[model samples]
Target: MLSLRRILTVSATLGILLFLSFFLEQRLQAVAFRVVMLSGIAVVMAVSLNLINGFTGQFSIGHAGFQAVGAYAAAALTVYGHNRIFGNLPRSGQLPDTLQGFLLGAPAMICALLAGGLFAAVVGYVVGLPSLRLKGDYLAIVTLGFGEIIRVAVENTEAVGGPRGFTGNIREGIYIPNLTSFFWVYLMVVVVVVVSRNLRFSVQGLQYLSVREDEIAAQAMGVNTTRVKVNAFVLGAFFAGVAGALYAHFEQSVSPTSFGFVRSFDFVTMVVLGGLGSITGSVLAAVVLTALPEILRSSLGAEFNQYRLVAYALLLILLMLVRPQGIFGRGELRLDRLFGRKGGGGPAGRDNVEDQPAATELR
Candidate 1:
């Protein structure tokens, strides 16, 4: 079993290589590095959403709203700063001559990412406060509505280009550097998975499960259900926002369409297909889902466009029928249990199970 410290060290080393690959002058190396960065972004999204949808047992469809906040926040800052420096957003395929210089020279870009995350957290707080009152489909509906509200709000906001959307010639931040590589993204994904897996085993994570299982029982046991729920939602939103920021810069564009309700549903589908409470499942689902479309696009070219979604829907339906609990259910899918830390010990540990009462003497 790799200790947490050792795992982190390995991740850091890989990240360094990915970051440096951007300047390697090798096209293959650069493309590989960018793929890693994207994988990392996906990891961030999957892990964060796992907290609320998996651990906390909440059915939220507002994950994309947080991502939007992050993307716009990062994109806006990049554009504004680029305008300040180069007089406009850079055009496609252009590289900044200063790439070899200090990494993270654009400090505002990092700030934008952080700000986007914070803004998403704030939104989480507001939406979670009320929606937490409901359960099951009711809760899902409320969150779905929240997601639509965010999309419409962004569409109406003129400051950010409103409905038409905004595109900026922005560069990736140096903290990561254009050195964005596959290994970097893959490493980051590994980090998110590791962190999330650890959290699921921690004591606080147990509390989350308790709440997820039975609010009344958890409250009886002195667990603060409200706090647990809010924390899950907010923290998940924070990471989603960060992923959004990374995505915005990676794509160098921001639009309301990118964060529509369908996007939120996609994340939910990943969580569901992966298993409602399995970290390993989430990771697997994210990779499969993210790559599926790209694979189809590559293989079928433009002709496969309409069938892509049809395939997605069919896949979802098939999964539900074959494995209603998802690929992992409340369990994780790890090859070596000995190498990993023990999680919360299955669904039975949750507080939701009811005890049968003894028969009365009179009866």
Candidate 2:
């Protein structure tokens, strides 16, 4: 059952945010809203990717591949569906009830997300089947190749506009009047974070950790390492797909280059910098990393834009020098730890003191 009190609390908070977003003429509101959206997306991407990279210790740089699949799948359904049903793409200004009903119904968005996730999972299975046999750098190379292949495939696919890209009306021209509001994005992010937290504490998540720890030993202990690893891979792909769908709709554009190796590196950098297995760390790092680049670009302008990359490079070097294990290392950062679950390994069931490989293990 939904908690009425919690719902009301959230609603009230969101109402305030919406007012600030709409009413305030200050540029700060725009920046804040963008930050919130970016943070939400980052949380989704980081947490889901964590399932494979952090919990399962998989070396998958194909994160963006799944995202691309989801983005196109969702964008195509809405854009094509509207054109087919209405005989023309709904323009932004106004729309008839037929299109409005179709677009405004939250159910369509949910369906699109499901389609995206399922498609990405299918791709995950196909990719994982061949690549899982490899190890370490070999696995990373295979996943990297997979990402490039996805980009190439997207670039050549005329249905989605190939390299030219695709853009059309989203929301069926309903002028839905603030459908992508703060509350919606915030709720999605919160749900994702909570679900990830619960999954990390579940039996399957423990199995993922077992695989990460030692595949041979995990297999000896009756864990189906292959299934466990694939579960992480597919599940992570699903969330990545979801995030991509959200981003596509938010930006109202779809491009193959948008979901390429550089995007994958951004995600990996967030996970590695935060603490591979630490959910809290991932969320924090994602928010910081995503915003930092934009902030630098804004403040420094084109003249200093290149320095932003240098800054990140220097930060990476410093992180390696100071603590190669990462800020959290194998340690998790859950509120539960402060209370009593310390060393319990919230989801993975490993001893907190156990030595685990560094994020460099993926590289």
Candidate 3:
């Protein structure tokens, strides 16, 4: 049974979103709309990676492979499944209804996104199984290999347009609004942030932190370290998959080349920019990094776009030199920070502490 308060909250949020989406859809130009949507996707990816690399202390970087998995799966479902199930592509006459309905005339893009996320989670479990045995650079390299393998494998599979790309053809003339609309994208962003925050503050979340601090110690304390690690990977991949689905539907296509090493690196950069273990930081970094290039391109001209990467490298270097922990340094920018609340990694905080042997300090 749902409480009235809960019901009202959901209702109010939906109303606000409808208003927001409708208003913005009317006013914004295509480019601004695209940037906002892409920022939402970046938020999902960055937050997901933070769970694995930041909170869990793993350095795996094959994030793009998971994204690809979701993108292709969702695209295939939309493209091939439509033909098989409906026997014809969607018609524009019913497009508004189709888009608004949960039904998959093309399968509501949400369905594809969910399907993609589920598939990616399963694959994450499989990949994470072997990954649990590795550590440090070895783990990073292995994950990188996994990503490369996924790209090559997909490159060969002709069904999803293989190297050519999944065009997401809908019988030409069928108008499919980009599924990464402000409402859907922001809704996922909220869900991702809420879920990640809840997990970080929960009992299982504690186990994740313990494992990150010391695997041997965590095992000694009876925490199922393996379970925690695998759980992290699965959840991370699931979100990444959702992001991929959004990416595909937004672009109206999918290709192996999009989710390559550079894409993976871009995600890594987000995680690093936003302090590790800091959800707030990740969100901020995602928005900034994603919008920066586009802003530069529109304002300073396309030629200045080349300087984006250079700026990133320079900013990253300066950050490392001045504040290696990142903008927040394993902390978060909260309202309290503005109000002068100083926090420490005491029993209440998460920072590792040292213990001196009793009675030996004087020596």
Candidate 4:
């Protein structure tokens, strides 16, 4: 079903990601690489959350709960199935560079990621069924409770190490192979961004936007608001789960404390700091927020790193005060817009004018 342009775009993206991953793996410092990978994960989280909070106008805040489900599910699979699936393959700190190891390991990793995502999507559906009927603060409360419940449940579950955390022990033959790499992380980033951008322009996405703009009116217009909201939740949760899988594999560990309300709030902050409905804004915010802490730590001594939160809080406060609607105010960044060409007053111009009312409402 894929078109020629779509296939070409995907092929070119993969080629670029492959080259960059190899080059960066060889040249980037360890800390820099970690930051970059974390940023990619953040990008996934922020963009996915935007689909719900921005596009769908749902204020669910328990994104970390879905992320937790994915992380543990993927980690458990990789840890328990490593020996059976990978055989005598030796565990390494990074992905296997050799062709044989890649052949043996890549499929399992892909399956694990898909399983995690699907599991999270199921959970999202369950949560969305009752909760999406509520709006604004009520929905947020339900979601916040959901996240807390996940953390508490994880704390009590012994099979996953409970409070101790899941660090796959090599001696016990349990291992979570380091399968996450720049190629995978950025690949997901690109996928999420592209899908989000396309959805924004699609008919289904218009239904989502309508619900966000006015639920009652959207329903009157024959939009199945509940279905749209649930779809958004599921899609968002799926991507968050994949991102969580990547995080678990990259960090080589999972803990109950990692996916907490604080983490969910962080994603919300990124969405708010960026424009609510702007994909590029979310990406930019994710990168900035992810890297800011590392930059602070490197510039300020380790002893002074504790104060970084104070600076982060202050920055957010200032930004909110200055531009409460966010950087782009529901509009996306475009090269043509930047250069003031206005699509040469052609079909693109007409499209822009047609879209202006919705854009104004969204803002």
Highest TM-score, which number?
A: 4
Kindly provide the TM-score of model 2 when superposed on the true structure, using C-alpha atoms. 0.79
Clashes of 4: 0
Measured by C-alpha RMSD in angstroms, how accurate is candidate 1?
Answer: 7.1
State the lDDT of candidate 3 residue by residue for 217-264, as single tens digits. Answer: 777777777888899999999999999888887787788899988789
lDDT of 4 by residue, 151-269 (tens): 99989988788999887755675667777888889999988998998888777878888888888887777777889999999999999999989989888889998998778978988
Backbone clashes in candidate 1 total 7
Tell me the lDDT of candidate 3.
0.78
What C-alpha RMSD separates each model from the true structure? 7.1, 6.2, 5.5, 3.0
Q: Relative to the unseen true structure, what is the C-alpha lDDT of residue 229 in candidate 3, on a scale of 0 to 100?
A: 88
**lDDT by residue (tens digit), candidate 2, 98-187:** 335335534556656676778888888888877777778898998899889989988998877789776754334432112243434555
**Pairwise TM-score winner, candidates 2 and 3:** 3
lDDT of 2: 0.71
Full-model lDDT for every candidate: 0.69, 0.71, 0.78, 0.84
Positional deviation of residue 84's Cα in model 1 after best superposition, in angstroms:
7.1
Listed per model in order, the count of residue pairs whose N, CA or C atoms clash below 3 Å is: 7, 1, 2, 0
Q: How well does model 1 score by local distance difference test? A: 0.69
* TM-score of every model versus the real structure: 0.78, 0.79, 0.86, 0.91
For model 1 the TM-score comes to 0.78
Compared to the true structure, candidate 4 yields what TM-score? 0.91
Residue 67 shift from truth in candidate 2, angstroms: 1.1
Q: List clashing residue pairs in candidate 2.
A: 200-347
Ranking by TM-score: 4, 3, 2, 1
